[model samples]
Target chain A: MQTKRMTFPGKWLPFALLAPQVIITLIFFIWPAGQALYQSLLREDAFGLRTTFVGLENFVRLFRDGAYLNSLSVTVVFAVGTTLLSMTVALLMASTVNRMIRSRSTYTTLLVWPYAIAPALAGVLWWFIFNPSIGIVPYMLEMVGYRWNHRNSGSDAMLLVILAAAWKQISYNFLFFLAGLQSIPQSLLEAASIDGASPFKRFWTIVFPLLSPTTFFLMVVNVVYAMFDTFGIIHTTTQGGPAQSTNILVYKVYADGFVGLNLGSSAAQSVILMVIVVVLTVIQFRFIERRVNY
Target chain B: MVENRPWANFFAHTVLIIGVALVIFPVYIALVASTQAPGDLLRGTMPLLPGSHGIENYKLMWQSGVSTANSPPAAKMLWNSFVMAMAITVGKLSISLLSAFAIVYFRFRFRMFFFWLIFVTLMLPVEVRIIPTFQVVADLKMLNSFAGLSIPLIASATATFLFRQFFMTIPEEMLEAARVDGAGPLKFFKDILLPLSVTNIAALFVIMFIYGWNQYLWPLLITTDPNYTTIVMGIQRMTAEENPQWHLVMAAVVMAALPPVLVILFMQRLFVKGLTETEK
Candidate 1:
């Protein structure tokens, strides 16, 4: 909230400067959010006629609904799976690349570009790789007598989406992990090594603890990414199918409202997702504030 | 580095090599698939190496996409994607710069309320309230147009915050000097602020370009017309066909992915700066 010590002399100029963003935000973001809130409290009969007020009934029903519960659990699993897989791999690669003097930038250049790939494209790439009949992985899996069909199997479909989502995220996490590693005082690592500890022991005891802030920040971010941003990944690959196994909450909102025409339920779902995002954003900002002091 | 252990160095290199290989594996397969003849991809005979049909497949998709999918040619889709991305990047940057300049440079009434209103955009992503947003767009008759594709998405809380943070670092004396020199608010903003923001703008340009180019669901929801189908969503339509031609699809995928990937490679420093500095 700090402003310039010296100020610009303006009454309407500032408003003019802020108009475009404020207008767009109001029209696009605030208005729709308000509409969703209002609509969540109302309901209509099956033929889009005979409306009635239903306060919290949609939310109450969603908790009792089997599909909604499944979507919630699937979101948790996908978020945790993506965060863990990408962070672990990125931490490993970051630590290894942190050691190399000459090859660090080269390795980084190779690893970082995937951050640019669309989630939809990443899904297609992995979907092709895991294609049952023609994919190389499935062909290899068959030699070991394991079927890899995602089209008919829920678990396989889940795994396919998870891998695709995690793959796109690794580059983003790696850059953060690398930055975190670089910021750690090398003197501490050198002193720990001089204590006759092995390299692995030094990493576990010293480097790992120092990277917690970055780890926590990335964890929240990855969760948000998995929950909301992976819509494209799921849409392109699974379409929440194999019996709605990969139907995360965001997709469910779209599906239920737009596809199922269940307006009240979708509005309620949207409100819930908004609450979750607000909570996560607050948590992320809180961690960032705490990280500054550390 | 503290110790001279050769084995440790070897282990590090091995891990990095394997990590890089895993990262590159899917794209490599996509590349190989694009180069293969259509028949080579079926029956578990997918080749490990590139085939002779690379040019043929890319040319086919670029000229006339797979007819079965009813998707437009890659050339048209890529052009659409470029226009959408540029519109979004330019829109986001210009609006955010102006708003941040307003917030930082002026003392005004209801400023805090306006700031919080802007902050609300972060709470509800396009996904959560997508239905109502779609309805709004429909009522406004923005469907299947560039205005529908980019404008709603241009109000960025992150970019505004980024510019605010950067503007805060500018020495206050610079503003005082401008004021003393008889430079008005618009004069200072146009001459002084724009030049100072060039680097931040370039950095954010890379990130926003990718964001706009890679959009799938928004375009999918709004633009039912094939004319406005972005490359990202267009490829999805291609694969949703009854008989997907793997060769042409991969070719389309490669083309769709190339622009943003190349942008990152070329402006890596700026992209990384924009990305790492972006979060909260």
Candidate 2:
């Protein structure tokens, strides 16, 4: 890349323009992250006031705590499950929509509507459908002589959360994948077809590789979203219930800090979650970046 | 070899139509259930058809404390949502636009560093920072205030990053031309850059608005009082107590979800355009 030389006025203007954003982000974002880190080191007394530093004690407690371990496993399962399912479905949808000759915009718009719905509302929607007595799907299942219960089992609850989270993500990943698909040159696919390759073969050999970059980007984003964003549904539906089967790291953090008032433990969980996210993201970038042509 | 296969096209369309229907069925169920009476809803006998109890449900929802001494009115909660969303939208847009313009249009030391700093924040979800953010709001005495709800979210790294990328795409010759015509930096931004970035601004505005509208946890945490309850918080509150009113809760959820749905429907073009632009 060529370095463009800047005039004196140009040199100073950008900093001035960026100052407000920098200041605001530092105050609100960086400061809070710092506070979370600092608080993680301090032990809080019963009255919600920090009294002394207990370095590494919180982490030790977290490792020894069974509930914390369960929640960590749940978080991993939820994040991985939702990401895989959502990305796969999104890729399928994107490919299908791309193949269509008409109503592409309509299909795309309808598909993306679920993304517009609040996650909280999506939870409520699923809650109603899965309601044991009044929920239509569950009731229909019972009527058909099948027992379907989400509230009574941890695995069921996890499945519900995964489904709701995955549903919400479909539109987002679809939108990106569609954009990625659209950017691939028509000539390449036509040339593959001309060489007597089937549609499936063309997609596998040509289109899939071309779309890998978008797929990788969506994977990182989808994983992050699953880890962080699905708390609303968890809070509303499960509250990490059925003997804490559905409790994830983020929900555990919220429960400990806000509801449980165990700020130290919450902060500790926060640190752990952050570390995991950062490590995973670094691994993703290192490995996937090489595979992404772009 | 096959230029146009009707059977293949038919099979593809059939599969896609089913996929699309599956995608939208849940939302359709929600809308239908929203129109039913509590009795019908509880019985699970509510037909898929629109019901006569739409107004009744709305009335019950309003009386359920979305409005009054006993309950906050649904309309008031909607208004609260609108106010908070609009404030966050405007604040995020202006801050993001200014920052983007500055980063792209001006050259400064640590520019790339600042970009990465902001970009990294995009990955740090509210879950990780909620505890500290709660403390900040409590310390600021902004708890239960709209400012507390809106301010923390005003500077979105994603928005800033997107806008900066978009601003970079603007031809430098325009800015140079304005500068040569004796326009200062501010004038150049306002006269040349701002006008050209309207499409981006519109797309980002809708996206940020939807984001603010859908925010659940932070607002739920900061706004302790019912008076400050946003639509999402209100919906959560509806289910928090014993003997939770499912009908009223569903109604609230519907009302809460309406704005973003309507915005997306009306601005579908801009929504896609915005996402595409951000990727670029």
Candidate 1 residue-wise lDDT at A39? 92
**lDDT string, candidate 2, A35-105, tens digits:** 88888898988885556999989889889999888887888899899999999888888897887767787
lDDT of 1 by residue, A1-294 (tens): 888888887899899999999999989999999999999989989899787998989899999999999999988888898889888898988988999899999999999999999999999999899988889999898889999889999999999999999999999999999999999998998998878888889899999999999999999999999999999899888999889899999999999998999999999999999999999999999999999999
- Candidate 1 Cα deviation (angstroms), residue A244: 2.0
lDDT of 2 at B272: 77
Q: Scored by CA lDDT, what does every candidate get?
A: 0.92, 0.79
Q: List the residue pairs that clash in candidate 2.
A: B65-B71, B65-B72, B66-B72, B66-B73, B66-B74, B67-B72, B67-B73
lDDT of 1 by residue, B1-280 (tens): 6778798898888988888899999999999999998888876767999999999999989999766777988999999999999999999999999999999999999999988988889888899999999999999999999999999999999999999999999999899899899999889988998999899999999999999999988999999888897899989999898768888889999999999999999999999999988885
RMSD of each: 0.9, 2.8
Q: Model 1 residue B197 lDDT? A: 86
- What TM-score against the true fold does each predicted structure earn? 0.99, 0.92
Off by over 4 Å in 1: none
> What value does DockQ give for candidate 2?
0.55
User: Considering every candidate listed, which one attains the maximal lDDT?
Assistant: 1
